[model samples]
Target: TGGSNAFAAPEAFQTRSSSRPSPPPRPDLSSLASSAAPEQHAVSSVPEQKAATEAGVLPLYKIALCCLLTDLKINCRDSLLVSRAQAPSLPGYLDLVEALQQRVAAAAELKDVAALCSVFSGFLRNSLLPSSCSPDVQVRLLHALAEVGLDQRRE
Candidate 1:
């Protein structure tokens, strides 16, 4: 070998100066876009889905479960699966709750007992909206109320 320091690195890296590294060359975006399948470009074009894909919070059910458990005076913080980073804002949740309320109200107005019953059943069965209130009695009471509502005149 020539009289050179074995410890010194060879020009394995391209550098602007002996001590300074230059930035890596930018990739040819046009070539990349052209080379990629058409579907890949389509997915990236939709900003909402692209953003959601890049960053995401936990599922809605987890948030609902936590809130439901909290309302029932159950401590679940120790077992929470979502971090603060993943938690959605309370303001954002208001719209979601309102939408759900409106849906339930519509079902009631339409006398869709099955839809209403499904919601009732979900309250008891699904972890999303569990309640401490007497579900069986409440359900029977709700059933009777709906029946009575059927006989009432529209205002």
Candidate 2:
């Protein structure tokens, strides 16, 4: 006898959502979601060198390519788009990369704190901060660098 209720199948059918658009994101939920995550604008901002690092290709080589691109007044951001597989085929970057590596090795060999700092500053200026970046970008990049304080070690 209860099997007669089987005709209720139509009533159990779900309402179609096509007639109604979803509600817009609520400000509170949006703010909370944002708070739980990083400031995307800040996080996604490349600040010159980051774009290359994010490419996740031949890290140092691509990073140097980004730097070299900036030197040629080319936007390094484009170089960051190259895939890792294709990174070797771009140009003859090994020489430049090797020279930079040598400079890094030289810096690593330094026993003097001042010399090490000079090399680090040089890296920050020439490698990290591209000349093509706008002054505001430079300031933004410097602001990030400014957070560090060199520890005092007895000479």
Give all TM-scores, in the order shown: 0.23, 0.19
Best by TM-score: 1
The list of candidate 1 runs beyond 4 A from truth reads: 1-83, 108-123, 126-155
lDDT of each: 0.37, 0.35
The TM-score of predicted model 2 comes to: 0.19
Q: Model 2's lDDT to the true fold?
A: 0.35
lDDT of predicted model 1 = 0.37
Steric collisions counted per model:
0, 0
Question: What would the per-residue lDDT of candidate 2 be over residues 1-155, giving only the tens digit for each residue?
Answer: 12232112122122432345888866775555544436553544555566445444334443453454344223433442243233332233334334443443443222222322332343333334434444434333222222211222222
Residue-level lDDT of model 1, residues 77-132, one tens digit each, is: 22221332332334433343343444434442223333333333344233333233
